[model samples]
Target: MAKQWLNKVLELGEVKGGLAWGRFLFDGNRWVTLMEQAPKGKLVGTDYHGNRYFENEGDIYTRKRFVIYAEKRTNAYNPTSVPPEWHAWLNYINDYEPTTFDYKPPVYALKAEVTATGTPKGAWADPDKRNWLKYSAWAPPSSGARGGKA
Candidate 1:
């Protein structure tokens, strides 16, 4: 019992040091979540996006699954950031590992919020809002304005 508490304390310290000050100090909800999940979970695999997946089966009924976000430690992490295959495993939709299936992610999966202001690049491209086709080239008045012969 003492060892578990010590381990939890150590893990909390590590998490506090590794992440940003805002995440450690302000995001108490995620801190509690990490505290709950860090002790017993076993790391299963890392996805292409750097997200970590963990599972714990302690002879209890249902196995527990957790994920560590690969993005910044801020609260900006979204469910869309998780890939489909990993999402299935995290939600217990499939017992088999995602690697067992030959699945391909769509083009949108590659899109990310490139700007610091939380605006997505490829996903936020709306033709109706900002249409590039509406722009036309500037043409000179005519030959008569320049005193050119007809």
Candidate 2:
């Protein structure tokens, strides 16, 4: 009864918005406590991005499934930022969850935002030079040259 009421209330948007509030509702006792009542599987693992993954065998409403919940970080939401590994798991590539399996992010993978002043060695910097001459028409060779051919 309480769970049903909570669900109805959330559907009405009474819980509130924003990252902090959403986090509190989804991860806090308000939501988790209710979710616990429902049939849920084990939590596989969380990525550097703070997205949690979960799975369970065939349930009443659906078959083996994958679930993800975003973190409550200050940064605004960006669905495209999800890493490939997590994407594969979400799409059902393997039965085993990444958290349980041996998963390591590649060394070259982008980890964080780049600072403006800190241009680490080997990093490519824009020369800022433009090839505007290419767009214009070609010009003939100079007359002063010693070339015999026109």
Candidate 3:
């Protein structure tokens, strides 16, 4: 009940002119409201996706570091949005936190996979011909480009 009231007050205060007050109030119990408790260690860093990571000595609630996924815009729950790096940190592959460590993502790994060009052709466009050559026909040469005789 108290937490709900605090959330409402924080929201109202934000709508008003007290921006910092609202932020502080909202951030004060963010871990509790979101993750249901204070983070065990320091908040290391936040990704572009808004997911925050934390780290501390191995203890209860976690054997190593752990992460909290960012709440959706509508505050709905979804776990698939968590990025890979934070996921590794959460699983305790490295002791150093993301904020302190120099993170270098693999060049190819960071690149997005692109699908093959062109949409699927409908029945009106062309019939499926498995053995047909897909190349386009070449245009006839222009007189100007060929330097033709006058």
Instruction: For each candidate, give its TM-score against the true structure.
Output: 0.55, 0.39, 0.42
In candidate 1, which residue ranges exceed 4 Å CA deviation? Answer: 1-22, 59-63, 99-150
Clashes of each: 0, 0, 0
Q: Sorted on TM-score, highest at the top, how do the candidates line up?
A: 1, 3, 2
Tens-digit per-residue lDDT, 24-101, candidate 3: 445534524333432334557887666666555555645445455555222233455555656666766655556677
Worst 10 residues of 1 by lDDT: 122-131
Cα miss at 89, model 2 (Å)?
1.4
Model 3 misplacement above 4 A: 1-36, 39-41, 56-58, 61-64, 73-75, 111-150
The candidate, 2 or 3, that scores higher on TM-score is: 3
The sequence of per-residue lDDT tens digits that candidate 1 reaches over residues 1-150 is 968775773554344454465565577656664666656767788787777777767624454887776665456556666777888888878876776667666867864332344444433432224433546889978767887666
- Cα RMSD, model 1: 8.3
Candidate 1's error at 142, in angstroms? 25
Top lDDT model:
1
Q: lDDT value for candidate 3?
A: 0.52
Candidate 2 residue lDDT tens string, 66-149 = 434353333323455456777677676655566667767689977643234533343344234344443677788688785676
